[model samples]
Target chain A: MKTRYHIRPRHNIRPQSCIYALLASISVAVFSLPNAAHAAGTLAGTDIQNVASATFDTAAGPVTIQSNTVTIKVDELLDVTVSSTDPGDVITSPGQTSNVQRFRVSNTGNGDEAFALTATVANGGDDFDPSLQQIVIDANGNGVFDAGVDVVYTAGVNEPVIAPDQNITVFVITSTPAGVVDTNRANVSIVAAAVTGTGAPGTSFANAGQGGGNAVVGPTGAQSSASGFLAVQATSVTLNKTATILDPFGGNRPVPGAIVTYSLVATVAGTGLLNNLVITDPIPVGSQYQPASLTLEATALTDAADADAGNFNGTRISVAAGNVPAGQTRTVTFKVLIP
Target chain B: MKLIIRIMMAFATLTGASLAVAATPLQLSSDVFVERTIEGVDGTKTVVLEKPKMVTPGDSLVFVVKYKNVSATTATNFVVTNPLPPAVAFNGTSDGQEIVSIDGGKNWGFLGDLRVAKEDGATRAAQRSDVTHIKWNLNQPLTAGAEGKLIFRGVVK
Candidate 1:
């Protein structure tokens, strides 16, 4: 009975029909199975790597750069990473005689970022003369680089690309002008730029392979600043006086008179050049103003004509022009007569 | 088919709820304070140093005042006035604050309306009042927990 039934069931089902049924079943199974894994893979293409923030030390203090990273998808085509390194704190004393002061510039980022380091000094509003205080660019940040060893670059071209965890040194030098004064403070700014690349080794996978490839990384820039104070001091000023009496009382009673000599000295205790400075010591009430016989001497005076008329004859003696450089002492001598 | 539809609807609802939770606004709070005091040559002198510190004759003295709005509602059209001290000399100023001293702080006018005499006996339009105090005319309402500072400078005698 089973054999008879088996032959009777398939009257006219074509082989082509069977083939079509099999194809339909396969199509249905393929469509029904989850395609989430493929969708996720496509999404990985869109993920981008970026720098969240950057920080560095500067002479002005701790300088920090924030959220300069931009995301880019394959379709978008453009991506940017911004970062900066600051020069740590800087220190300079008043009247630092050293030709150069050194500063260190370092990067403190985990990612291997590249940056251009450039320094700009706003000499405290032209407080420093460029000719007087030479600004020699020492490619190496070390302060001790000799002139022969240092290389100076042109603007924009001068900056060097620094790698992460790397640093350079710069030096500030003072020229040896005879009466150069450093009274104003100077501000120096150091800026850094970040080099663009794929995310640091581990983060690249989060966005799927889509993010890792086809992203253009650009440099992120940052700046650090510092200030220095320069002060010129005047140490001292001295005045000497000589006095002579002419033939008083006309007698041998010890010539009835005596020759008198005195010295007046003034010292500047503070920094800065004193302009239009005048010094006067009036004759005491008991003494008469002597004229036509007083002599004066001064270090800052270029010529005898530079001395004021009152310095010789009047009650007050004045030095027309006086300049006291830092750490220098000046002296003046004068003669007076008692009649 | 019905069971599958129900599961799909439930998943959609959960996703919607999660998205809604992520869109909430963040609330923040802040505070500020301001204080002003006057000290004269003696303890009771009428002169109010723009700032509460001693200044040299030629030095620049800057006076700053700060205030904060702590109330939930913004404070609108607020006004503050500072009288100039007699010993101080007024210089040029920037920003919104005005300088006006008439009859010794008895009346206030815009600095452009005042007349000043120069050392060479020439007269010029006074742009700033010899600053004894500073006043702020706030046009915008200060939001809750919002703080601001006003600054002015003068030469100390």
Candidate 2:
């Protein structure tokens, strides 16, 4: 948008002067609000000075007198904010180890201060308690976690000291034990507090601020906590076998040279994915092997150990169902003759 | 007794002002204090002013300007002006006759009658944060040895 300024011609002011006035006013309006609304309020140790003046008429002449200046130094505010970095409940399998729930701690105060960190996994409202491992900080300041790079947090040791408006990422490591039912959730929480002190708002710690000024707790009470949970999804597989007999005498009796058909159905359960699932069945003692009779999900397989998932040795049949999703079933059928 | 002593002092000052021919006779002084609410043992709360030792953001402060006329004659056309500190935002004053400046003392008027220029070449109703200075006029003449104080409130930005 273009702005047009109409200057009265009778004022005898030059056009260039008008342009300068316009620019000066525009700059002042744009820069004034941001300087007043700084998020981290005024910096500590800032001296604010004020003076008052008065002018009055005297019998001899007009006179003006100014007052002495009074100065006040700003004190520091101690506040902290903690929030969960994870989008939602983290998905994990039973017996999973070293699963991490992330949280970010920020220093929302106007001073340089150290924060003490604490984590708890044995929360009462959780379905199953996850064993507490250790709390670690993002040592390199990177969002991604590195096993050996990140620093493990210990009480009164290696605490992070952040500047005003700065944040640090923290990870809570825990392990889920076996036997925990599927769809169960375990919550973990972390708390970060100013090492100086924690108390009600306006509570002041004398001479504890960055520049030796008093430190007063802000609205956050100088400490904060955030929670994240882990959801369990267990996986397993089950197989069933059935056999049918057909005799040459047109009877369903167990006779010699009777053809027998065997079917094996494998079904996977739970919400997790099962890996390296293999099914094997040995040939019966009184049965003769039928050539090219092995089929997986109604697909034929050779009697050799080839690139296909199905293979048959002299005495047994095997099918490698690499990965199987939950609620899925696979059937393998083979024919055998009773010699 | 205190009031009598104060009045006697003012008379002595007036005598001295008459002897001096060139002195302006008007004296100004400023002070800042913080207000805190204290609860009494009987469950009554009272606000008390104390020296600001730990001033933080969003804290309320009171600025007082005291003026006195020490000359033998009445002082007329007396005006007091105070420019707010950069780190403080004007909160209001108990006196309704005061005029405020929003453009660094360039213009002055009642707060409700003032307009602030915006960067978009538009004007907006002046707000508390836009106040840059405050002024009060003593409409009546200040007689010899007369004294009074003016006050306004502000908050740390």
Candidate 3:
């Protein structure tokens, strides 16, 4: 900041210097009314403006003594904002490394700031954990991060510094660990704190050099943080079918006029979901589907073509299975008679 | 440093016993997830199993607190308080009867019952955004060897 101002008379006076000191002291009392408790030597936000007027009796009857008003403003102001635009980008397949999300960091405050960066998996509330999470910046200027095309982000001196209003887009790369099941989620958080002050190169949050004229989080204008997560999705399903036949002689045989019972079970092996399921099985050769013999587990349906009962389109049999959830299976059974 | 708290849940069948907090042993853990809808193989609407992952703005997060009675006795009068993260906005709680504190745990009540002082110095009905913390007081004693869960939700700011 333009060196803190102090009252000074042009001439050298013994008792007058003491009075000038009093004036400076009075000015300090005015602005410090509401202490702007900045975090450290990082100054941003509101400026202090004031003027002083003192009236007194002079050589004449009554004269007014008014001193010029001095204003103090922050030059190297500090302000910044960081956010992930994509928010909840997802990646679940294990061993897959990709740029699934993007973040933007901008210097919204006056002057410049070198933002220190960091990333975390989660603060809890996740179904699964992040396998290998990393942060990257678009090194080639292409919105997309091509393999071996982007650069990894590391904190310290020489970090990317942005001027006021200017912003950069960075990517959050993640890989799901092996064996992560469906519904497992990993939350990732990224932080960008402004790095200011002199002795710049090596200075960090600890022993950090003075930044913006004030401290970090010091009664200030802005601080930026970005966070989000990746959730895993892997669905697996299986179907089981069986058949049993009975002959007219009460013996098991595939003979004409014999009734055959068929069962089909649809089950999901792992955490996953299958919707709008329509099961179709062509009618067996030389066999006739008993229209009224269709049963979904226990309930019997009409033999008609429009009801919940199994439908036979002259050659194919179809059944509607709305949705199949993980570990949830539905079975459809019907009887058919040989021609 | 951000802490990833893991809440484990246990289901105990013991019932009919009333115990005090001092007499029962309790365990708690927490996890988060985002809900998403996707297509199903049955030609109907299905869930994508989005799970918890990289979130974007406007995503709703389900915060689940799994609790179990690890001790040999049942417990009651249990209370749990969870503070909202700075980057999150409390849209609502899965426990509708649960009271919420918006003034940093200073005072709490239902959304419709609470009020906030505005910049103009007028106190008006509080909104969901004013929520800061959630409190859960189990209505029933958690029996020994019994496990269950409590859940609330918020959005990533």
> Which candidate number would show the highest DockQ if scored against the true structure?
2
- Per-model DockQ against the true two-chain complex: 0.01, 0.27, 0.01
Poorly placed runs, candidate 3 (over 4 Å): A1-60, A76-181, A184-225, A246-257, A269-272, A285-287, A301-309, B1-157
TM-score of each: 0.29, 0.82, 0.38
Q: What is the lDDT of residue A137 in candidate 3?
A: 73
* Model number with the top lDDT: 2
Q: Rank the candidates by lDDT, best first.
A: 2, 3, 1
Off by over 4 Å in 1: A1-99, A110-114, A123-142, A156-158, A172-183, A195-221, A234-258, A262-266, A272-339, B1-157
Per-residue alpha-carbon lDDT of candidate 3 for residues A283-318, written as tens digits (9 for 90 to 100): 788788887777776677665688474576777777
Clashing pairs in 2: none
> Which should have the higher DockQ, number 1 or number 2?
2
- Across B55-85, the per-residue lDDT of candidate 2 in tens digits comes to 8878888988888887788877788878787
**DockQ score of candidate 3?**
0.01
Best by TM-score: 2
